[model samples]
Target: MPELKTPDSLETQSCQVILSVLYQLNLNHENNVAMSSERRQFILDCLQPSLRQRLISMITYSLNQDLNVTCKLLDYLFDSGIPHLDLITRRFSSFYFPADQVPTVYRLLSRGDPTSLEKLCIGIHLDHSEEGDWEDEEKETICWYSGVKRKEESVSKVLVYNSYFYPTLEKMKKLRHVVLHGVCDNQALSIIGQSCNLLQYLDITGSSDVTDVGIQNLVFPPAIQKAGRVNLVNTRARTNPSMKHICTVLARDTGVDVTGCIILLQFCPRQWI
Candidate 1:
């Protein structure tokens, strides 16, 4: 019988571990039986820092095509100690399907990667053309939602609907632009006010859950004394005429750009032109 030899080099073993990780991630994403947690850990422990960096780049490059799988793999890697938010953000250049952005944002945020949150964009957008809608039967009105647009390649815009992501916001230090819709409430706003000092633009359209308390937090936070743009369109603030004056006062006092002028007219019955 011919002698059988095992590959003993760290390079060879690292390659095997990477392959196993890829397979396990894909299997988990597909709802198949994935490699056991113990097995996964064993393989991950074999990777060196250099190999991890290389894997991150490779994962980022492959993300667009296999986002679900790659994201899971990224999560595993992040948890296993290759935890650099830059790796996640560097892959943002790839086009992601609008529907997948929400889950992706959750995954990234839960990882507590601050560098990735600096300029993040997460939301669900639907291409409303009749042809596109008809072709993609799964994309019904229930799935179509408001999301953020990339304003500048440099500045990050993170848009989420009904985001209860306040817990994760504390980890973000360099956030600049944020647009949230749906169920974002006073508490979430307060969290942002307390944590995101560098916030420049804030749009909370459809945030009916927010009230004067949140507005107070946004206006009075010591960290955000500087001026910034605020859009409260279609928010609970519309029901309270008094809050309008508060926003106006904040804007005047701090040179903040406070929109939602139309909503203000609901109570005063005057043209805001």
Candidate 2:
């Protein structure tokens, strides 16, 4: 790993101060989540251009929502246009967005350089709207992604299985870490195994769509290749166990191990944690 440049003490202090003030302001409140465009501008106007990305990063983190939900407000915020929009989108290499954002993610990949992307994590937005529920803590709030409190019943949950989205991901040759929780499909998983040469970690837990066919694509590509960059494939996979043994047999000789979480396949067992 290369040395990372840490921000100066002053910038760190500034971030601390800004975060404190933001908490007090309650912009994260349910009522304010989908704030008016003017309100979004007000917050941006208060920050220096250099610090804007940090502010956005915090909001994105707090929301912990997929890029699709976060970007909805962002697109509105940048409606009037602002500086550093490109800076935020282009420089952000790590993405942990829901599968619904695949189209949006594709746009981000297509418009920007795919080589810049490093970590891509895609998972399903857990929908708890089951038969019945009563616990306050267990109840889902906001629109799944937003941290705001739920005002009413949420709209339908979406599961993305588009073919085009996978193609865009293939272009991300530099991608490394990936986590597909509850949303890993066979085709997409197959693409990741064959295309992502530099891939290090993949965590697919509780996903039912994956099977040995996908693992086959990952462990044995159609053609010969150079030394692989794979390090570990972690599977806390809980949904499908049928493919567990198949994966084990396929990768046992190749220094990869299989466990159960859907189907966990490690590229280098020695390095697996």
Strongest candidate by TM-score: 2
CA deviation > 4 Å runs, candidate 1: 1-21, 28-36, 43-54, 80-93, 111-162, 173-190, 197-273
* Residue 105 in candidate 1, Cα distance off native in Å: 3.9
What are the candidates' C-alpha RMSDs?
A: 13.5, 13.9
Tell me model 2's lDDT, rounded to 2 decimals: 0.45
Residue 74 lDDT (model 1): 58
In the predicted model 1, the residue pairs found to clash are 119-156
Error of 1 at 37 (Å): 3.1
Write candidate 2's Cα lDDT for 36-140 as tens digits. Answer: 445556865766544655554555554444465555434332321222222122234533444455467445444433444556544544443442453455554
Reference-based lDDT, each prediction: 0.45, 0.45
Error in Å for residue 223 of model 2: 4.1
Off by over 4 Å in 2: 1-56, 63-69, 73-113, 126-160, 223-268, 271-273
The TM-score measured for candidate 2 stands at 0.45
